[model samples]
Target: MPATPPDDPRPWSIFLIFLRLGLTSFGGPVAHLGYFRQEFVSRRRWLSEAAYAELIAIAQFMPGAASSKVGMAIGLSQAGYRGALAACLGFTLPSALLLMAFALGLAGQGDALASGALHGLKIVAAAIVAQAVWGMARSLCPDTPRRVLMLGAAAVALLVPGAVGQLAAILGAGLVGVVVLDTKAQTQAEALPVAISRRAGALWLVLFALLMVGLPLLAHVADSPLLSLFEVFYRTGALVFGGGHVMLPLLQAELVPDGWLSNDLFLAGYGATQAVPGPLFTFAAFLGTAIAGVLGGLLCLVAIFAPSFLLLVGVLPFWVRLRTRAHLQAALAGVNAGVVGLLLATLYQPVGTSAVGSLLDLVLVLLALVMLMAGKLPPWLVVVTGALIGWLVL
Candidate 1:
């Protein structure tokens, strides 16, 4: 695809298209990219391969849900801020609504059938995530230097764990990138414009910063439930990387420890998300339903994802300068390596170990890998197959 197709650039049209995509798209965040490539790039001709790849690069380095961030950025490039909002809403809504129903549906029942379904869904999630880690590792750490960085990042992240450790690993990798990759990034940064004006970007950035700083203070002083809710979810959005898969551990630690929600409910909702289409970040909506209600679900959804949207919008107008610098590109290369390692480590811990327990699980996982890597089955199809296999065997 070379450019946005000549037809409708209308925001509602963008919204409607994404809405359909959201309803149909499945697998996980990485798989969402595949769906995006098929729809927006291959079918719709909305972006060039290079532009899509750049969005992926940017999403990988940023906090919050990476898939959602890329969606918003694509919308921004095509139409503007309204486009961004439309894209996000259309993409996010299907899963959000489904998750909300899952939350409500689970209120009384916790039966054998439910347990069987949940287990099956988890197996599917494991299989999908395994493919993601494998694919990312090969592409992101193709060279020896980057391979070394990936290993180093995995070691640290495995040892340290949690949001603090994740932040440190990513930040440290960027600095290491400066030293290890290239010394010639002293080239002057270029300026580029986007759908949003520089002034608007600056303003959005200031708001992001203000919320980051002031939300905590407001939580401390007033002790308001609304402020507290926003603070917790907002902080999670601002800190974690990777996407919904990475978001899981951080959110579990934040909400479960405080008794804000229960372990049973959390795990159930998590399994439920595996069955849904669109971004797994819609997992937020399920949590919201448990804690606050329907409105809470909506509020939490907004809070947890708002940082990503803000950061993408705030930076996009100036992203040309950053993307243009060769030295910076080298640094990003290291960061990308670190990102792969993080995913690799995560795959082993929560995603891999948690799902595969016996020989049956092992066989299923291998089958999943083959189908994803070689068989060329769509992820949702693979997911359905995995679920059926899980129900039968696991």
Candidate 2:
């Protein structure tokens, strides 16, 4: 592993900072990036802006919760592996605990106010995703070729309509980029703070692969419900590309069919996830609690997040060295455009169709969009206001 950066802070301090973010950071992954930029880059000065943006790039290119992985990267750079752990725990636990408590309280209950709040939260998701789609499209799909790729990806995602479709869209876009995009331009780059040894990075990667392959086999051989649960969540965490919002369809496919949870509960938990302040993956905690209990919640939380931790540790050491490659850049460009498309498709389906049941809900979504885009309101406030409105009107 690499030596800790000279300016490394105490792991406890890192934990506290992330914990505060966990309590207050309310928007989805895209918004989390802004929160991170404000906290680490502008305020804390943990790393240079370029270094921070580099970390964001790594997180975006990877297959997990982008903001969570970026946080992990930041922590890892500051105080080595332990700092990474502290950061993740601090950022994830508050939301996980809140969602778990909500799950336990919500079980077997059918309160209208609660239902209305969830409905409003779902509407908030629609607005948040719409904002993300708009913002990312303006940036990532700026050119004609990229714009075409984005639209094609959206079409594929809508038609295929599942994990298979998503994967196909990403892969196809990447291939197209390899053939069409020119990515030879280079910029002055700063080194990432961490310098974990390639050997150690390899080990972390091997462990990730082992669990990825072995978990399902072990679950199959053991035929244990717990193992099955772990495998399902682990796989989901390992495959989702864009961020937390994009994980929705994959989670639905994995859990709903197995009778692990109902569609209503799933969407409700997702909506509740937005209400809480943290990575969207914390929805796993609610699902696990619904399935079993506190223990199950912990299990799912760890299982779902484990891959992100492993992947970041594995890739961080190599990122600075390999980031300048032309093919890699081209592929990442394609994947990013494809991700925008996936998010666009996602907005209309499970998020929009499920939440906007009437003209009023549609109006609510528009209002929420305006709140986020034009009003400059913090998402947490919007979420709270939405819940109240939903409680009264929905």
Best by lDDT: 2
- Tens digits of per-residue lDDT for model 1 on 84-130? 89999999999999899877776545455355545566666666667
Which regions in candidate 2 have their CA more than 4 angstroms from the true location?
1-8, 28-45, 111-115, 185-188
TM-score for all models, in order of appearance:
0.80, 0.88
Stretches of model 1 off by over 4 angstroms after superposition: 1-8, 27-61, 64-67, 77-79, 111-114, 183-193, 222-229, 240-244, 256-274, 357-364, 385-394
- Model 2 agreement with the true structure over 176-196: per-residue lDDT tens digits: 988788886355456888869
Model 1 / residue 272 / CA error / Å: 4.2
lDDT score, candidate 2: 0.83
Cα distance off (Å), candidate 2, residue 232: 2.6
Candidate number with greatest TM-score: 2
